[model samples]
Target: MSAALSVINLAVLARRLHDTSLLPALTPVSVGTLVYPAPTSTVEINPNWEVLYWNTSVYGVVDNSVILECGTTLPDLYIWSFTQPGTEAIKAVVYNLGRGPKIQKIAKTLGQLTIVLKSADVSIEKLLLAANGLFTCQAFYNIDEDPKVHYYYVHLTVRVPVSKPNLLMTGTPVEGSKLWMHCSVDNGTGPIKYIWKHETQNENITNLNESNSVIYVDDVKRNYTGWYHCVVSNAVNTESSDKVWLDIKFGPDDPQIDVSPKTTSEWGYTILETQNVSLLCQAMSNPPSQYLWFYNNFQINIGPKLTITRILRNGTGNYSCSAQNSYLNTSSSRTISLTVYFGPDNPQIDVSSNTVMDRIYTAVEPENGYVALETQGVSLLCQAQSNPPGHFIWFFNNSQVHTGSQLTIPKIHRNQSGNYTCSAQNTYLNSSSSRTIHLTVYCECHLQQY
Candidate 1:
């Protein structure tokens, strides 16, 4: 029994005995022990058998109501006492004896008070931090003057909800620099946890969990630009702060060019002199990238777009686009190739004949050339220059005889010698040019040297 509890029992005994003079001298004694100094009158007092001490702790939020329960049944006489470090007080009483429930000692700061008789519990409304302490409910059961003490004790702790956090950026963020952010709240209880969220420009979401309120981006990157928010949570409630945009200054990523009138040939993009061509460049950057175009590795234009009214052969080369971020002094480039194509111009036919007479007898001849004898071997080639080398087809006496650039005759006969025509075709341009040559077989018997 604490000194406070001893005082509680002394008051209960004085109330039950109507006559204050018959009460024995109050002596501080441990709970469950009775000290009797011989009652002056014949009136006798029954001793309390037990002193119940409750060790339960109650949790509550500020401005909320909590109950201090005293078992299930109401006692004949009960008194509630509180013990705090500095502010020791007790309230929450209703229907004491004959009087209607009269609340006592509770100020407006302590909130409202109500008593629940059916459960023998005291409800403390509008609770504050000042109410944080030990509450003892001393109840006397039965109508007897029995001094039995039923003590219901409660230890209360008050909490407050977390407030919205304020997110602060430590400094201006730049690419490759350290980025620091701090989250703080104006009002909140201790043990508050914070969480940070990052939502990118592309709608990608990332969550970082931390016990700390401060966060750091060791290496700030372009992709780190996004909306950031901090979530604050305590035991009572959770709140989120307003979002802050983190825009990081970065470089112009590698440039990519899109070519219009896109046709693929041995030359990257093929077009004719009469056709129009367009080239477009694009890059990912923070402040938008400026572009410069290069034709055959030479500066030719500027901006993201370039158009050719009429493409010529001289424009056929590696076209490059340089993307630059002037603020960061960084640049990136990409190159594409283009070609201006024309027709497979007038093709020429050359004939080479071989004779056994000298074993190495050779001469380059044109149309109407002779093969010497019936056993002479001859070969004819059709040559042309075009954007994409032309496909070739050959004809002997106006009829298709072979395909490709060359035609060969292993043994030449007098009847077999005739007009051999070669046609070069540019499949891409749908154009053709042809040239013809004739070979005649001459025998030694018909010598003109006689």
Candidate 2:
């Protein structure tokens, strides 16, 4: 008995136990041996497994590899199986008999397969499109009689990258016709989403399609003509197709007429008489446009530009350009008024009503002519006919006196009795006309016997 007790004490010391009892109580030890004093180590963590490690979702691409984890539990046996996208049957792919990985023919058919026994992870290599579905990983730690079996489910999706897209169309779009545009892809996985983009307009036109893969226009307008492209996208990747051109055939638009040597006026354009001018017509049309020029409602010239060597008073009226598209049988016209500023024609200088005109001389005395005037509040008047009206300048004896149409003398003196000149100027035309009149301011003492 003593020897048996000594053997029991030695057995307890070997186990590093401090209990004095010969047969002490021992807590049940877990199946696998702990690597360290604590528990937190496994295989390398893939960022893709952040959701799949605890749950049952996994995403993978075709001809690629995936890792299916079975938590942190260490198992003695592992069996990998799979269920296709639309099946309820579970088929075994590979298994590990606590020895090493042995891949089955089913696994080889799907792709290359590996079972990592150390970390309880199933690695699928060279994934195939047919391998997309739910996968089940069954792990066992103890004997089969009362086995602690763990079941881990992973939902796997195999995807194919999106290929370049294509658009099916024939010729240029015509106005007032049925317009149909179709966007197609060679192959892709999952629910493919299509987005249509107008490069020139910088807008998304996918909303224009009810199915989101086609574009429709009942009556295409000019604004719809531009470069267009389609983007095909799925859960795996996205790709954009090459751009295509959509030309909408229309008619000549309203013509825009512009003139050279043009001056801006409140009403229209202003030009000096005898000045060279050119009128240009601009219009947008499919087959170009024929231009016709009109002056005062009279057709005068044809072509895109009309040249006038010397603009005259007769040409100073409403000028118009008519653009006609022969192909579409449509025409547009625009008009602009041109003002030709000619001159301060002929200016005449005259004395005020209070001034007396000799019987021989007229009221408006000619230059170097005589006018009878004294201290009778004599004033000079300058009259002229001009296109923008005329500004008059007064000069006495060729010296500048005032700058108005009327020059008044409050008191007439002999010094003021020199040749008074009035200059009428057309500032716009830069032309001037002048008339000089001689005034004789004599005292009544010298004026005898009328």
Candidate 3:
């Protein structure tokens, strides 16, 4: 009867097998059919799939004898005697899609029925449900009594991008001097924010966190001098930078004084004679001013023209000028009233000749120590008178002899004797006198009697 309907269709396919939602289902069951002394059937497989094929059909009609083997021709055929041994389970789940739950989980171990998914959640159905990958597997053996099933599918793709915030300027801005602004974000994910702007203060705003980037201004005025920017956010992305302008340059101002012959003369009129005079000082700023000159009130080291080489009469009083820069300072002209002039009042020295016993008996005249005679004899004359002309010097015993106004000893020998002294020099008096003349030498001796 067709072999009892193939044994009731193999017992209803093994009672409709069961894989629940452990996915992947493949079942094939048929036992003891082709009747022929049958009593050698075995099939077992639960090591997930490995048992290619096994077939048999034997009948006794005229030529019927079939058998296929693998399992080493099954001695007593025992591959666990027919399935049931597969239970090494592991499960993990984490999902925070609406950005609220905050998920985290980790577990490891792979071998035998291997399933490895370290570091998951790169989206894509959470990495195929944590690598159970829509499951599929099968294996049946009985020395290959025909049983096999294996199928797998896992697909995933994910990418993330949203992080950009940086604006810096902690230094380099001095217009009125004092500025700082910095904002950064390399990581601290999402919901971040900071804003500091100035395009000339548009309602001036400043709100920063994440341990602040920096924003300090002690004093920087001049309307805080223009352009300075910063705006960084996170709710996805936002950044702006490129605006910093501060120009500061300081100067030299506050200086004044100018005078040149602004006259008021008295000690001898006009060009303030008796010598040297120069007075002038001009200072005007914007970074160009520095001049100081004073006379009568001291401080006037000469140069910048306030010179008075010899403008005597006590350099004729009051003269002032001062101008400075680096912030306010002024003093100019008027204080001057200088006048000096005079002549011919420095001279007085006269020596009528020498006598202190002729300077104790003159002699020592070697070219100019007085006593020099030979042009009509008694030489010793020293006169220095001034208002202008004065200089005459002659000293015999005590050195120095002969220098102007008069000192002439001509034709007076006997070594011209010594000690005569006379000196007079003027620019302002110096006079001396001494005289001694005992010099007599007349040669005319002739005695030849032997």
The prediction achieving the highest lDDT against the true structure is 1
Q: Per-residue alpha-carbon lDDT of model 1 for 1-450, expressed as tens digits?
A: 234434544555666655343233322222223221111222234443444545567887788888878767877656555555343233333324424444555434445666785655778888887666656565666535444546576666677778788999986587889978999888777899888899998888889765579987788877778999999998889999999999898778888889898888654777786688999999988789999999877798989999999776677788999999898889999998887887688887777776522122346544355454676787888998876679899999999999999988887777876677889998988999998766667666754542
Better of 2 and 3 by TM-score: 2
**Clashes per candidate, residues 3 or more apart or on different chains:** 2, 0, 27
What would you estimate as the lDDT of candidate 2? 0.70
Query: Which run of 10 residues does model 1 get worst, by summed lDDT?
Result: 30-39
Off by over 4 Å in 1: 1-48, 85-120, 142-144, 171-175, 193-195, 198-212, 221-225, 263-268, 296-300, 326-329, 343-450
What local lDDT score does residue 446 receive in model 3, on the 0 to 100 scale?
A: 12
RMSD of each: 9.5, 15.2, 24.3
Q: List the residue pairs that clash in candidate 1.
A: 1-31, 95-101
Per-residue alpha-carbon lDDT of candidate 2 for residues 1-450, written as tens digits (9 for 90 to 100): 122332343343334433232232322222223110111223222232211223367888887898888767766666666666544345667666666766667777677777665677878788888777666565555433333435576667788888889987654576666687788888889599988777555554532344487777777777777787888899989998888888776777889888898687897998887899988999988678999988888899989999999888667789899999887788999999888888797887767636555333556654455545466677778999788899999988888989999888877875666788889998977889988777777667656644
Q: Give the per-residue lDDT of model 3 (tens digit) for 1-450.
A: 122322332333333343221122233232322111111223353455343333322111111111112223212111101111132121222221123222223311111111212211122222211222111111122323433421111111111122354566655343346666666656533455566666654545343332445777656544554566666655435666566654432222232333344443333223434566666655434334556677787876533556556566566566666555444343344355454533323322222223211222335423323222232345344443232244555666677766665665544555655455554444432333333333332222311221
lDDT of 3: 0.38
lDDT for predicted candidate 1 compared with the true structure = 0.71
CA shift of 173, model 3, Å = 7.7
lDDT, candidate 3, residue 202? 54
Q: Which ten residues in a row have the lowest lDDT in candidate 3?
A: 76-85
Alpha-carbon lDDT, every model: 0.71, 0.70, 0.38
Give the TM-score ranking, best first.
1, 2, 3
Candidate 3 Cα outliers beyond 4 Å, as residue runs: 1-17, 21-178, 182-212, 215-240, 249-450
